[model samples]
Target: MSKIYVLDTNVLLQDPYSIFSFEDNEVVIPAVVLEEVDSKKRYMDEIGRNARHVSRLIDGLRASGKLHEKIPLDNGGTIRIELNHRSFHELQDIFVEKTNDNRILAVAKNLHLEEETKEKGKRVILVSKDALVRVKADAIGLEAEDFLNDRVVEMDSLYTGFLEVYIPLDMLSRFYEKGELFLSDISKLPFYPNQFLIMKDVMGSSASAIGIVDKTKVKVKKMTFNQEHVWGIHPRNVQQTMAIELLLRKDIPLVTLIGKAGTGKTLLALAAGLMQTEDFHEYKKLLVARPIVPVGKDLGFLPGEKQEKLRPWMQPIFDNLEYLFNTKKPGELDAILAGMGSIEVEALTYIRGRSLPKQFIIIDEAQNLTKHEVKTIITRVGEDSKIVLMGDPEQIDHPYLDAYNNGLTYVVEKFKNEVVSGHVKLMKGERSGLARLAADLL
Candidate 1:
């Protein structure tokens, strides 16, 4: 059954090459989509870059045939520019003034009407990223869908990179004595190499655990984590296990974590960084920084000094600091922050000029960053410094970023499987109940 997909402005903006995503489905780009693309072609950010890319793509397609007419694609589908849509017909009933949303809906409505008259009754689906656009699509009698390509992997099934398994009591003894445990020996087990294991005795009476440090060892060595247990939180799942691997791993020079807002990406990295820097003195200092994209554009001038200007944007970081310091008093945390000259929490804007060394660097909210920005940050890591980039791709505030193209994704897709790097996708929401519910429902 062939379907007609209408590419909304946001869909194109979300992914310039989204037209190719439907496989062989016919794709229709309304003339209004081009208008929208033209307007954004001058943008300085990712959205602008994507808009320009769309323009180039449509232009290149013209070489095959006229865009105004249906052009056959090598994939067995056709793409055409929908120029027959009336600009403002019946729009007054829905919107007071001419708006982009209404304009897009108007195109979809006209397309749906045209489809209804066709003998085959083709499906006219409007693809967009804006929630309101999808709502308007439904209201105006057109099928709509959000661009899912940019979405992070499922919250529940996002790759944790490691897993835990429970084995029978006697199996533990045989493994301890033999030293090498074969995969066939644990075929029914949910274990993987480099995966942390908590081999608890199946019987409730015996409360014991052995970590699976090296799965290839074949000899089951008893795992131990008396050190990391000092903190109240333990590696409860595979994601945490991978996280522990990245933190304990001094060899991997780079690590990246992608998850939603409350997935404990930043918290775990920060805690491990503090442990390594303060407790073990492995690194000389801990450096934390994030881009300063104000909720909107930042005001040109500030009423107070540097710290005052940073207060609003840095509040989240401060909240983490306050919790870590266990302080409620005003200025007390700042005093501590100042005391530890080893710790630096500067803005990303200032990092351009320096080469950092022998430090555990953490860049938060990295999904809001671009590939170029990530490259700049990574290049600054000099000598023995290990950098951990963590952020929620779904919760990005940047206008230009989507999950596939954000700095986190760019780094992961580019660096995964490299010897000096490790990547973990945190699936479970370890935050409180309300936060997790909001993440799931909202």
Candidate 2:
């Protein structure tokens, strides 16, 4: 049955193309949503970008026909702007507020009542990304649902990029002897491109090997770089070892590292960037950037120059760099950073319209970015440049993003089958035993 999906402002802000997602259904945009989108269009962030996109999309649709009336979409669905301008007379007694959210709820309630009077089997559902709004809609006896078109995967089923398989000692020995084994000769388990494997010995000899799954073959891998250490940091666990291999690989240009707090995600990425830029000279420079998302509340404004104001937000990156440089004295790290002409540290705000060629780019706290933001970052990568995105999906500070829908997870899931990308989910925390226990238990 074709149902009416009345979208909230947050839905459109999250995804401008959401109107085309409901196949063969009627998509209704409350007039209030447009007002909210217009208010956000002035900012120069991801939300502002999406708001502008939505306005442009709606304007483009207006050329096809009057938006107040039904407009045919490229998909089988129909989209229309609801200009009912519903008053909160009925909801005023309970909601008791003239806020935009209340106005949106009034629109949904009016549509729900109108649909209930019809004879056809039509349903009116209020779609939003706000939890409180959905709860209020349900309290008012209206059907409410989340806009979940962008969730890449369920949290429990997210790809770990690695698996364990038991191979016989003879097969393992043959793998070691030949340095590679065809996938057809192994068990009938399927593997995505670049999927790591911990091959345990089935003969109970405590012998094990680590290898990456191939489309046609599997090659044994050793932790030579992890053992030797890169920029004074060694892989503390198997996942970290796997991460370094993916990071240092010249062929794989895109790498993603995900884990909880204290998992050494940022530290390892910094170490790899330093090794490739300073030691190996594989890249011309190293660029480290991250989204400047506040944890809870904004600090308003700080009085300083550009670098002074950004120091608080970029301090985490500097901490890792200082550790890598073994700098403890004040201004010592700043001197080293100034002396190193090949290193660049800046906010993601300044990355647009710049071409980064032959650079090792590391984006920390990438989970705070939207999929479109991540796309912009990836599309800016020039030839012969490597980009590493590291973040903990569970620790996202972005209001609209969650573990499944964040940009980091989106890239990890989308690029799992691609040959140029690799991912690793660090399981154990190497920061400290206390920190590891806190991450696991708390």
Who wins the lDDT comparison? 2
Assess every candidate by TM-score: 0.75, 0.95
Q: What ranges in model 2 sit over 4 Å off? A: 203-205, 214-227
Cα lDDT of model 1 by residue, 340-436, tens digit: 8788787887888799999999998898887767888999999999999888877777865666667777777666435577677787787788888
Query: Candidate 2 — number of clashing residue pairs?
Result: 0
Error of model 1, residue 371, in angstroms: 7.6
What's the lDDT for all of these models? 0.76, 0.88
Kindly report which residue stretches of model 1 are placed more than 4 angstroms away from their true locations once superposed.
71-74, 90-96, 152-155, 174-180, 188-193, 203-245, 256-268, 278-281, 293-308, 322-341, 349-358, 367-383, 391-442
- Residue 250, candidate 1: alpha-carbon lDDT: 82
Which ten contiguous residues of candidate 1 have the minimum total lDDT?
Answer: 217-226
Model 1, position 133, has a per-residue lDDT of 85
- Model 2: per-residue Cα lDDT over 1-442, one tens digit each: 8999999999998889888899999999989899999999998888898899999999999888999999998888899999984878779889887899989999989888877788884798999999999999999998999989979997598889898888888888887787677766666776777788888888678988888865443543443343578788887788998999888988889999999989999999999999889999999999999999999999988789988988999999998888889997999999998998888888999898888889999999999999988999999999999999989988988878989899999999999988899889999898889999999888
Residue pairs whose backbone atoms clash in candidate 2: none
**Model 2, global lDDT:** 0.88
